[model samples]
Target: MNKLWIVLTYAVFTVLLIIPLVKMTTAAFSGGLGALGDALSRPEALHAFMMTALVVVTVTLLNTLLGMMTAVYLVRGNWMSRWLRRLMNSLVDLPYAVSPVIGGLMIVLLLGPGSAAGAFFDHIGFKIVYAFPGMVIATLFVTFPLMVREVMPVLQEIGTQQEEAASTLGAYSWTTFWKVTWPSIRWAVIYGVVLTIARALGEFGAVLVVSGNIINRTQTATTLIYQDVENFNVTSANGAALVLAAFSIGLMLLMEWAKKRRGVH
Candidate 1:
């Protein structure tokens, strides 16, 4: 009966969360699945969809490479490196504690119109603020710590034995990484990549400040959602929102699959 009560309590909590999500999904698909499909195919909507997709893909790839390298180095290096790792670990807390708008402001202060980097970019005729590059960089900063945290623990857990074993077999570092190291932590890499992608896709406060939201040109799905909702185009906004929610669901499924695969192995 104790087990039964525990299960009942968990079930109640699950239902409380799941009920609203199910309603939203149903509402998104109302007028039938065909309507949802049609909504997703609209031209501006497609642009937003593709832009967000590119952002997720680009950010995930960048974060994975950077995170994997940083995690491995932190695990393998010396005393100075230990200090650097501690610094990075402490820096990760900033994203969680700082307001997104504050992050945007920080970037703007350093890269905005009159700042030194901004002036250099102006001299080169390459605008950073209110542009794609700025948006991508800002999103990268906000979402990066998630990837680092996810991958670092897995790297720490796996340790150097597998790497040492490969090295002793006359394998060079790159060869050993591809041949042995990668296989051991592939799931961790994928999980961290997915988390990075999800966070990048949903980023609003930081992205908005940099993107300039110039409608049909620079507006990402997220910023587009905000613009639509602000303009009272709730239907279109909800449509954009549903696409984002679908991406979120896809991430959840991917994480579940990764967990199952790890269990099976």
Candidate 2:
């Protein structure tokens, strides 16, 4: 029975993951390495990748800082009322519950050009909707939960005893965080950052809706792939997908390495 289960698992994995990866690889290379290079070297493709890198870096940094703060507050803020903490905790998971498309639409509704906030920002010469800022915001919405979720459990598990001890020993709050709290949650923060990067890289719906997929301005790698497919440029789409897949695979390996390091520690 165990042998049968093992075979079944492999079969399922191959069918769902391996086969598709193989197919994509084949398709991406169908026109040879020169074609793949050409596809990726196009002006639009270069811009799309650069936009994606910007979003990923910005979102990851913001999410890591804010998410860790939020998790610490939720877990350790004695000043917060019980109900308030509960409310905040529930809100952290809102992105996971809500569809990304809906999240994008909400951004559009709240801050698009027609809305008051959007108009205000636009009048101030800072466009939010259908621009780079909007893309970052949308990606942030989709990826925020990842870091919070990763850090919260670690904070809970490590408890506040050490932090309290540090404070009692005359350490300032910032000192306590750096000396007593940071080391404990560092791995969790790293994990959250990796997850945020991965999600931001592949995010399509929200970014598309918010960025308007403007070429050379707000286009991301995923949206570029969508545009390519829509234009029946299958080769270009395949090449772009392969690049994303390569990044994802590298992240996966890094994640595994981190997991092993955490385990050893």
Candidate 3:
């Protein structure tokens, strides 16, 4: 029965994942390496990739710092009442509950140029919606939960006993975090970072809406693929998608390695 189940699982995996990846690779290289390179080296493609890298770096950094802080607060901070903690926990998962498209629309409505906040920012010579900053914000909204969820469980499992003991021993709060808490949750943070990078890389719906898909301005790699498909440039789209898939696969491998290291520790 176990062997049968394993066979079925492999069948499912091949049908859903392996076949599509194979198809994408074939299509990406159908015109040969020159075609793939030409597609990726186009000015617009280069800009889109650069924009994606920027968003990924910005979103990953902000999410890592903020998500870790939020997770620690939710799990260990004594300032919150039980109900408030519960409320915050629910809010942290709000992104998961909401559609990325809807999340993008919400940002547009709240911060687009027609709105008061948007107008204020615009008046101050800053743009939020339909720009680079908007793209980062949209991506951040979609990926924030990944980091928090990863760290929260580890924090809960490890508990605050060691942190308290460190405090009792005259360690400063930062010292306690570095000395006692960080080692336990560092792996979880790395996992969260990997997840955040993957999600940010592939995020389409939210970034699409918020970015306005402006070429060389707000277009990300995923959005570039969308644009390629819309323009019936299938080969180009495939090349871009293959690049993203490569990154995602690398991240998956990194995650597996991190898991093994974590287990070793």
Candidate 4:
């Protein structure tokens, strides 16, 4: 029965995921390689590609740094109260539960055109909403949990004895972390970063709400696909979608490899 269930689960998964992906890929390549190149060669599409890359890379770096610091504190900070630690843990999962649309809306309400913060920022000649910065923030908020979640378990498993030993041997705090703690958690960090890239690359709802989807300005690859579909440009839409799918598949493969490597080591 368990074997039957496993087969059935694979069937369902393949039907739902693999079939659609195949169809999408077929649609994308329908016009051949030249057509795909043409679709990507357009100025707006090129801009969207660059913008998406920039946003994903920036978010992944920032989140990795911040998430590692937070995870270390949560794991090693004996000074923190139990309640505070629990609160922090809950907050780490907040983005997971909240809809991305709501996350974007929160950013808009807090910093969009008419709000107090918006007005203050406007006076300072900086805009948040309807800009690149807004897109970055929305993507960051939506993908923030991945890094912390990935690193926390590894940290817990490794414990702090190695770190303490390094310290007692006259290593500085930074040296101790680099030589002792980081090696153990490096694979976890890589996995988290891959997940972040995957999430950030495909982010839509939150980024849409905040980015205003300005062509050649704030539009990302996802938004470009959305726009192309709305305009009934199936070829262009499929091309953009195909690019995103390729990105996701590549990153997912990398993530699985990282996971397996982490387990083996």
Best by TM-score: 2
Ten-residue segment with the worst summed lDDT in candidate 4? Answer: 254-263
Q: Which ten residues in a row have the lowest lDDT in candidate 1?
A: 73-82
On residues 146-227, what C-alpha lDDT tens digit does candidate 2 reach at each position? 9999999999998988988998999999999998999999998999999999999999999999999989998999999999
- In the range 1-265, model 4's lDDT, one tens digit per residue, is 9999999999999999999888888888889989989998999999999999999989999999999999988888889998899899899998999999999999999999889999999899999999888888999999999999999999999998888899899999989888999998998899889889999999999999999899999999999999999999888898898889988988888878777876787
The clash numbers for all candidates, in the given order, read: 0, 0, 0, 0
TM-score of 3: 0.97
Q: Candidate 2 vs. truth: CA RMSD?
A: 1.0
State the lDDT of candidate 1 residue by residue for 1-265, as single tens digits.
9999999998998788677677667766666777766666777778777777777777878878887877776666655566787887788768878888778777888998879999999789998888777777788888877766777787788888888998998999999989887887788887887788889989999888877777656678998888777887555666778778877889889899889989999
TM-score of each: 0.86, 0.98, 0.97, 0.94
What value does the lDDT take at residue 250 in candidate 4? 86
Task: Pick the winner on lDDT between candidates 1 and 2.
Answer: 2
Q: What does the lDDT come to for candidate 4?
A: 0.92
Name the regions of candidate 2 deviating beyond 4 angstroms.
Answer: none
Query: Candidate 1 regions off by >4 Å?
Result: 1-16, 19-43, 79-81
lDDT of each candidate versus the true structure: 0.79, 0.94, 0.95, 0.92
TM-score of 2: 0.98
TM-score pick, better of 2 and 3: 2
Query: Which residue pairs overlap in candidate 4's backbone?
Result: none
Write down the worst ten-residue block by lDDT for model 2: 158-167
